[model samples]
Target chain A: MKPACKSCTKEHEKTNYLHMKQQIIEILTELRPEFDFTQDVDFIEAGMLDSFDVIMLVNTLDEKLGISIDGMDVVPENFSSAEKIEALLKKNGVK
Target chain B: MSLKFTYHNKRICGILTVLPQREVLFEEEMDNYNFSPAKSMKLKLAMGFNKHRIVDENTNVSDLAVFGINYLLNNQLIKKEDISALILVTQSPEHFLPATSNIIQGKADLGTDMLCMDINQGCGGFVIGLMQAYSLLEQQEIKKVLLINADVLSHKVSKRDRNSYPLVGDAACLTVVERSETPETIHAVVNMDGRGASAIQIPAGGFKMPGTPETAEVKEDENGNFRSLENLVMKGDEVFNFVQTKVPPMIEELLKIAGKTTDEIDYYFFHQPNKFMLNKLADKIGVPREKMPSNVVENFGNASGATIPTAVSFNLGDVALTHSYEVCFSGFGIGLTWAAIVQKLEKLKFNEIIYY
Candidate 1:
């Protein structure tokens, strides 16, 4: 087995990040279909998401993407929107 | 910390619960929480909460417990003299001075010779009360222990607070535990993390933070729930995370100590916070929906200390009285406490839910 070159590994990581964002959007939409995930960036402030919804989203991400979310990381901003959740995953080294 | 042990002689002989006559539907309270019709439906679907039974303002914890205990005595399921020890577990008691157990014992005329005490506990009250009762029974002199778990939390929460109001219902349960000639195996595991104490608590109205005129002034939270500092506040996300991550492993540890598997257990009665949370926990723990019930929250709301017994009464009340079962009970929340107990019940008389 040969190790992947640094450039190739970086390219794969970038692709993985994009895939995680798309998957996160899908999860949010499925969990609460009434809300438009693309337009609703301020989920908490807009009342589009409640505590129960956040928990479902957390479990879904862990189940679908294998992203282990610590209880401390379940803040308002991290779960505020699809883009924020994607960034949170990247910050936690999801890939 | 985690404590694991067994009770050899004590066995639950009978169980009874009392609920208030009043019922509150979610749709009626939509305006209180500023919830739209779609949002209300979403909450109902996700949380399995549509209606809750709450006691009126005048009713207190002692009222419900006494009513249930009187029913048990009147039906001849238990005699007043046969009760060797009385333990009342609740966060809401009749008075802060005299132990509520003493008051109940006095009201029931059980005599002062019987041991009576009160414990401050919340959602995990049933298992903890059972443990306490079994400990008293282990002393050998106590032949029968009456463990009363009650919480009239409806009085403590603000009706305007959707997070707390729709989730809490007032109720009380009296479980008669007696000494068995043949030792029955009962396994209990209690785990506590004080760091999460503030997750679900009343910030004021306690010895540490006594209530004042200022505390009585109602204020609206960011979520639109009107409450005072003395009222109950719950950080839902913290609690959900705690249960999802901590409870399943604790239950597995309980099964391991009992030298049994989930397959052997006949029923799993967990503290019913809501449908979504319970279903998620059932999936994480690998217990089927049939085995673990999620309707107590919908039917009775989260009655804190009384939740597990209420769950038992709602699901298995009729059949449990006539049949034998290998039962597992788990409760978590408030004190950031979580506990599980696995035991066997043989033809215990389970009475119907009384409306007081």
Candidate 2:
């Protein structure tokens, strides 16, 4: 069984997605170790994250940290930067 | 009573067409570029449409439609025969009244014995037009239907609408639908939400929101222009959610109905909007990297209804139609609409089929 979502523990609006950047970085590095997430460049625009990689990213977010990601949540604003992804997860109540 | 149904009968018989931003030919200075600051920074959160050409200040919606019709009629040996019907789908029309279809019918010389009309559908207009053509062909009496889709959203798009600047590029697209010797049945389903209608919509210029001095003059942004984002404000996040929520599932249901899976599909041609949105949809559906079609946004901008066929035509060589076995086409956005259909491409090259 999947663990309870950490995001569900807090208000959807008040959660801090920015705080999860490091964790996201670490997970991404593990998934695609060659990915140098340290760049200020946008992962998607830079051609690093294609559709295949994005699903892996979303799938991991759902598995490790416990967040409910919806389809609309995948836009560039949310997933382009690590900070944005963190914020989206927090919005979903990711602790 | 039940009839034995078939999913593979109708094939994408002839050829598909795609026009880049060069076609619309915008005359306004505001139509020059996607001024969004995020684009340079790579934060292209919204779709970025560089410069679009709808009709150089000289031409209008009608002119663009006729261009496509001439191409279609000239190619086939239909013998100046009366078309069974003509459907023009557009958000941009010349006058406030008569259908754009009339102009196309007049230009194509398709006889009056045909049914001619316009459908005011948004982005999904092209696909819907194809379905209508499908219906007419099913009757057996109608043999060919010409579907023309054109839009000059720049008319409504304010110059300074930074967010929507990249969101819209003016253009027109036309597809000649015919009863295939092996016609593509175009089994399809269209979904929409009037509530979400306001998500990506214009506030004036139509029946519901007539244009007024106040509505027209208001500067939506610091740039003092109005386009899709300003005149037609899109709750970017919300609209994204709407498509994300609706499109993937719809594609799944479509594939299920067709009794096929991702592995069986040769290609999934989507309306090129943005890399982010395309990647998101492709990810959600588990579509393989190779099976996915071209994302023409980097070049054509978003030609509204034209993107699907454009992608089909753009990636023709990559998929190697014969080897892939089948290709699927889908379109989303605008009308808050979404649709998908499966097709098998005949082994004819575009040059061989269209003779272009």
Candidate 3:
């Protein structure tokens, strides 16, 4: 019974992660609707996001998830993909 | 760490800014780079940049500064002898050997007893220049100091460098600081980090990497702007992060040190980088947009050291001279440097932007 409960908790956490990713996608789309976030994981590399866009994303994440991103976290590596952004959010105690 | 300083005896009496008459619209100029109209429109709308002033190739920062100083002297707004020290704050000097201030002294024909020096600074130069002027008053018998903040950044940027060229304007400002007996004090906070020095720099033309044939060879950057290492290059993301993360806290600390809150201040003048960045900063600091003038870059482009004085002279115009103001001035960039000054200005005789 304990093993089953652990499995259920793991599934729940996976669902939560998916929800956060969806929220991030929504934020990116709202900012620059012309780009497809799914296809372009290299958003930072492709020059899809300018400095203003990054600031807006940071502001939105703070407003939505109650997380503060610092200068260190603003690196292109952390913002290159939705998955990486989610990892950053988790590292900042978003969960 | 932050350095805090207070000055009780010095005050700025007047400010005059001069700009080149020639202008270039970004949309029209971007055609050479093949920057799409849609993208151009987006940048214009988002950055608040439409047109910028550019000087003729032959003109330098000294030409503009001399013109402004002569105007002040000729109009009898400030007498030549009243200036005990002349400070030229700029990175783009007329010559590397004789400091631009000394040459300007010769052209302005000031007395030999006067002190003249050029400070190699940009961006937050006005605040730094003002700080130096205040300190001089404390030491010497100086009664009035002529502070000239000027830069011709257009000459520093390459024509093919769309990222920087379109946003640079050429201008110079002359401000007169005199010893005053008023109780008003100037409060300043300054901070610097060499870690971010390379973020905005001309990689060559200095002693460390003297300009060579290869340095002048133009190559296209990933962003498509073509420029050599000899020209100015800015890591926009790093600068943006620095301004957003570091500057607001500095301003907050400055207000705390001054024993004033954001609301008590009448206007917050900033070194104009762009409308978007300034708006974001205002939101972060909770200063009202009305009090923050972010359009300096939009109308006149970023004149580096002269941005603040240019903003004041153009935005406030003569109205700044008519009333007592609790003004907060901040300049951040290029040295990866940021400085803020909070002071009170009473009636002033001159405040205007002149076109050359």
Candidate 4:
């Protein structure tokens, strides 16, 4: 198999990031179907996510994404929004 | 670091969980929380907080244990004379000096030939207590071990503390562990991290921080939950993370060591912190939701170390009385300690949940 060129690698990375972002949104929506996670709002501050929800989110992310999230990264901040959760997944070495 | 052990010819012959008669519904206490109705309801649904059994304010750990043991004795489920050792595991001992086990021994009037000792442990205490029972049975003179796990921790949790109050429950489980002539291999594993001790603890009332008036001063945490130093404080997120990150691997390791696959085990009677956590843990470990019943918390609250036995007696009481199953009992929390036991439970002489 030939290694990807620089432009090809960049394109692949962009696609992966977009796919990861979509997955995060779907997870957040599934967790609390009533909440609109697409909006750029703080889930924690808006009472959309509590500590228990954060733990559930982490568990789902770990299972769905096939990534082991660091316990230290399970704080409310990391799960306050889909964008933040996506960043957390990326930090955990997700594609 | 995991402490692994395998014991032979030991079995848990009986289990009786005594729950208080009083039941407090989560909706009744919803007004006590600092959150809105909708938010609190979400928490209630997520955490499986329906109702929990709590002892009267005047009750203590020894009281519950005495009641449970007396029930066992009166019903002839356990013979008092056969009990060679009395082991009481709890974080809510009646007195610091006399040892609650001795107090129970004296109150129950079990003969003086038995060894009475107390172990301070929380959720993981049941498995730890079983470990101790197995060790004691190793002695030639010892025959039956009366392992009582009781905690009236509801007394220690502030009613206003939304984080710990609604979930804390009081219950006692008296299990009779005895030597079995039938050959059996009981595999167990225990792992602890003291650094996470504060993850689930009552910060004061020990010698390190004696009970002072100031320690009893109720204060609000950042999350708006009210608690004092003397009350039980649980850092929920940290404990959840601990369970999620550590427990599945521990179970896998134990199954591996025991040369058994996940499907080989009949049931996973783990400590019921909450339904959500237990369900997540079951998912993580590939155990079916039905196999790992997480209804204990919703029904009787999280009874600390007693949860495992409570789970068994509550869910499998009728069937377990005459049937046999290869079960895995795991408990985690309060010492930041996690432990598991894999053994065959067969035809228990007594397996039921009685109300105090």
Candidate 5:
């Protein structure tokens, strides 16, 4: 059911980190149109985003991507942009 | 002024580092963590979080600090031996006795002789760390300061703690502040509440409550239970009321002190707390969305004290720091604390003069 990592035993993580980031941004944009979708917009002011969105995002990344994100790593700085979020996944060797 | 003499200077820097973070256990193709009913209804409703980062049990924050500081230093040609002061701020230290900064210095491959210490401020830690560096630099004792805001919120975090699960996010931030006569300087207004200190505090493992059966078994109200004891708890309405009433006035006072107006400042970075609060504050204070810098709440979930500097580092690339333009900042939360700092960003070339 999961593509386990030979070293860390993490699952098919990267495949989903990429897919969900776009999907979530699309979801967020549809929910709130005023946000500058071209770049990373502040969650609260953008209307559809908030703190819980990150949790949901982590869950989304996990369920869709299969990488178990460490709680300590789930910070705002990492998630500010699709680029940063994707970069974080790559830096961790998660994807 | 008798004579202008420059002494060995102390400055502060910041770095934000994070490790691999994902849920510990989850197996799903398209399932969403947001739909889980176990999470706090308010947390889910107010900001809409479902899954937050889960740092591994073995991973302490000092490692993250090392990663962050190394990354920041990799770009600049600076050696570790140049550092004079290092302040590590974290709620979770590597050990009960040894300061966490010592471990960070050891791992980051630094030379000996650093004034390393640990700070115990809950979330206002990063700002306090900045203030500490500022004081030292002003005294011209140390040459540089590393203000590391790193924390691992997993070991103490309860999976069953719905209230805190969505709210408390983790991260490591490092900032490098060097001595500058005409560089960006911070002017801050800081406040703390020791009376309401017990409002958000650890209930176990300390001299006051000493992790023993007789002392530990005392008062199982809403802490450390299977039902709702694991997560951080806050009287939201009380905290909200306090911030709304106090923060705006504080900003007004800070503006007066700096002799500037909302219109005069180039960039204003609020804590970027939540959508609801941001909306209210923006309306009340007249801080246009353009002036505010944030990648706020719903994005990274709340990185606690790391929010302010995180906003700056993430967004400042686009900001052209001109001599005429100045930056204004504010940080608030936990320990029921908040701070406002205003300063001018000076030119980077001020140090380059051909001396005879």
Candidate 6:
């Protein structure tokens, strides 16, 4: 099989990141339907996400994305927003 | 490391959970949290925090154990003379010198011939206590073991601390383990990570961190929960992560060692941390929601090591007394420990919950 060219690989990475971002938003929305997860706001500061919700989100991400998130990375910062959660997933080698 | 073992001719004959009559609702403790009512209510819904049983300041572990032991003895559900060993598992001990099990032995008049010891453990104490009982039953002389798991953690939890107080409960579970002639095979496993010992603990009151006036000073944590060094402190995220990552694998290992599948198990009577944690765990482990009862914490609070047996008695009390089932009992927490036991529990002589 021929290796992908640099430009194609970059485009693929961007597409994967966007897909993960959308999935994260969907998961967060399911967890707390009342919250507007689409907005780029700090879920923790807004009182939309608590410890229980964070744990639930971690479990859901692990199940849906097939990634094992390290316990050390379960801090509030990683789960404070959808973009942060996508970054966390990438850090966990989600793609 | 996972410590796996198997036993023959051993069975858990009965379980009785004694809960304090006092009940405190989450609605009443809403003001304790720094979060707004709306946020706290959302948490209450997610965590399944309705009410929990708590003991008064005067009540202790021994009080509940004595009451339960006497109940079994007076009701003739168990003969006092048949008890070969008494194991009291608790994080809250009445004194530092003499063992709390000795105190219960004296109070319950359980006779001097049997062995008496105290195991300082938390949530994983129930399964650990049962393992100890099975070990005692290995001896030819030992016939039956009376394992008591009780904790009065409410006294150690700061009421103003929303994280721990609302979920903290005071209860005792008295389980009867005996040597059965039916040659039943029981598989058990225990795994511990001492590195996470501080995840759930009271910083003071122990020999290492003796309780001082300074330790009693209340301070607010970043999460807005208030507690003293002497009070129970739980890093919610750390503990939740530990359970989510570690427990399901431990349960899988247990089922594999036992040569059984999830479908073969009748119930997963686990330590009730809360509804949210348990629901996530059930989903991860591929177990049906009905099989794993998470209502114990909401109805009776998280009684540390006592939650496993309390879950069993509360949910299976009536049917378990008359029918046999292949049950899995698991507990994870405190010692940063997680343990499980899979066996056929046959027609318990008594399985019930009583209010103290």
TM values, all candidates = 0.86, 0.72, 0.87, 0.88, 0.64, 0.87
Flag regions of model 2 displaced more than 4 Å. Answer: A1-70, A75-95, B1-9, B16-41, B44-54, B75-78, B181-186, B221-230, B317-325, B347-356
Candidate 4, superposed: residue stretches over 4 Å from native: A1-50, A53-77, A86-95
Q: State in Å the error of residue B107, model 4.
A: 0.5
Task: Give the true-contact fraction for every prediction, in order.
Answer: 0.08, 0.35, 0.12, 0.23, 0.04, 0.19
Name the better of 3 and 5 by DockQ: 3
Predicted complexes: DockQ each: 0.17, 0.19, 0.17, 0.24, 0.03, 0.20
Q: List the residue pairs that clash in candidate 1.
A: none
Estimate the overall C-alpha local distance difference test score of candidate 5.
0.58
Candidate that scores best on TM-score: 4
- Residue A73 error, candidate 5, Å: 35
C-alpha positional error of residue A81 in candidate 2 after TM-score superposition, expressed in Å:
13
lDDT of 2 by residue, B75-169 (tens): 66233464677777777777776777886677656687788888877767766777777667666677666666666665566545545554565
Model 3: lDDT equals 0.85
lDDT of 6 at A20: 76
Each model's interface RMSD (Å)?
Answer: 4.8, 7.8, 4.6, 4.4, 13.2, 4.8
Which stretches of model 1 miss by more than 4 angstroms? A1-36, A39-48, A55-95
The number of the candidate with the highest DockQ is 4
Q: How much is the lDDT of residue B10 in candidate 3?
A: 75
Docking class of 4: acceptable
lDDT for model 6 comes to 0.88
lDDT of 1 at B105: 83
**Lowest summed lDDT window (length 10), candidate 5 chain B:** B347-356
Error of 4 at B161 (Å): 1.5
lDDT of 3 by residue, B1-356 (tens): 47999999678899999999998888778775636666566667667768898999999887898898889988999987778999999988887789999988988788888899999889999999999999998865787999999899788898887667778888999999988878888899999888889988999988899999999999998777889998999888788789988889999999999999999999899999887678778877888878999888878899998999888888888898888789999999988799999999767789998898
State which candidate, 2 or 4, has the greater DockQ.
4
Who is ahead in TM-score, 1 or 4? 4
